[model samples]
Target: MREPLLRIEGLRTVFRIPGGEFAAVDGVDLEVPRGRTLGVVGESGCGKSVLSLSVMRLVPPPGRVAAGHVWLEGRDLLALPMEQMRQVRGSRVAMIFQEPMTSLNPVHSVGAQIVEAMRAHDPGASAAALKERAIEALRRVRIPAPERRFEEYPHQLSGGMRQRVMIAMALACSPRLLIADEPTTALDVTVQAQILDLLRELQAETGMSIILITHDLGVVAEMADEVAVMYAGRVVERAAARALFEDPQHPYTLGLLGSVPRLDEERERLLAIEGVVPPPFALPKGCRFHPRCPFAIEACRMAPPALEEIAPGHLAACIRAPVEQSVAA
Candidate 1:
């Protein structure tokens, strides 16, 4: 197997609140191998967005990375100086945020934004070359009339178009890794499928790895080569997408799978998780999910279970859940 394009080890992001510290991301370990897509799935406030921000060193002022390493192409990004980190951010790694309407500047022309992103990483490039490249990028994302749309402001474009522009800017420099945090959240179903298909096509052409953060299991099923299920602030299960869907090892994973709405099944009501995700500041002791976990036991209440390998590549962080039985049955 190829060396991982990005590897996060024991990543912990903490925020200072009124009285104490809160962990938005706690001890997360993940890897995105070159040319593979790793989908991160969880409900809201499960630390999915925080994990992405921490990896990029873009955590907000009151919050910061407390420990662990973010290794991109073997270099420890956490140790890099601010100036160097800025260079690496867009030149090597790029991100497409959740809301393009909010993320894109209202005043700037979409093309101008893309050009600025290009110039930020490559200051020596000619203005004409940058413009040409920007237009080409717009075309690559399948935006109609790249020349006309280039001069339009964010408000002038539709939601789907604005998202395409965001994607275009992120891929403008052909970064080695792209972190997409719910890139299709605000768009309609048809547009969402188009955006996802575009991402897959772009990945195939560039061989760039992607970390797709989303709460939609259907999206994960469609695009993910591997899946990581997170709850409260930690990953509860990690496995290849097929293995995860076929045989989820953790109770949370099973609950997530069970909650995915099925079109074929005739049901009186939709299945859903029992309770809400615990607040970051008030995470439960031991297993964060213990309070809501149907399979919680005394051991789960006493101490947090470390992520353990149950099969060749699958991992789960639940002490009471029987991994062997799940895989066998």
Candidate 2:
């Protein structure tokens, strides 16, 4: 296996609350090899978004990275000074937020925003040069009439076009790693497919790694080289995309896959994971997922299980992982 372009170890992000603090992202460990995409799949509030923000060191106020290291090309991002980390954020690792409308500046022209993103890393570049590069970036993402669209505000473009602009700004600096947090949310199915295709094509062209944070398993099936199944704030399972889809190990992962409708497999109706994601402050004992796990047993209530290898390169936090036996019982 090749060395990963980005590696996260024991990452924990916590937010302040009334009593104390609760971890929004708890002990997540993942990697993204060069030119590959790592899909992070989980339901809303499962800490997937928080984990991405932690990597960019952009966790909001009242929320902070309390533990672990975010290593990017051998340097520990968590240990870098604020100014140094700022330099690394866009130039080396950029993010495309979930909602482009909210993420993009409402008042600024799309072209100007991309220019600002580029200027941050290349301050010495001339305004004209930046404008030309910004337009080129928009064109690269397959946005037609890029020159005209550059001057338009976020509200002026359609949802799909706005999303493309977000992609353009993120890729403006040509970062090595692109963290896309639900990049296709709210778009129609056709537009969603286009965005995913654009991402794959761009990755092929740039050889940049992507950390795709999404709740859609269908998207994962289409794009991820590897998949991480998150539950409550931890990575409950991690495996190669093929292995994960073919043979899921953890109960939460199984529940998630079972919930997605499959054309190949006939089912009377889609399955649903029972109960809600336990609130961070009110997490359960032992396995965080025990409350919703149909196969959970007494052992699951004792203490939190550690992420352990169930097969070569496949890891799951459940002790009964390779959970087929539990399924049989």
- True-structure RMSD, every candidate: 1.8, 1.3
Clashing pairs in 2: 286-303
What's the lDDT for all of these models? 0.91, 0.92
Show the lowest summed lDDT stretch of 10 residues, model 2.
320-329
Q: TM-scores of all models? A: 0.96, 0.97
lDDT of 2 at 281: 94
Instruction: Assess candidate 2 and give its TM-score to the true structure.
Output: 0.97
Residue 306, candidate 2: Cα error in Å is 1.5
Model 1: per-residue lDDT, tens digit, 124-175? 9999999999999999999999999999999999989999999999998889
Q: After superposition, how far is residue 292 of candidate 1 from its true place, in Å?
A: 1.1
Segments of candidate 1 deviating more than 4 angstroms: 323-329
**Residue 140 displacement (Å), model 2:** 0.6
Tens digit per residue, CA lDDT, model 2, 1-329: 78999999999999999889999998889999999999999998899999998999989989999999999999999999999999998889999977789989999999989999899899899999999999999999999999999999999998899899999888888899999999997899999999999999999999999999999999998999999999989999999999998888898888888888888899997889889999999999999999898888899999999999988999989988777676676
| Best-performing candidate as measured by lDDT | 2
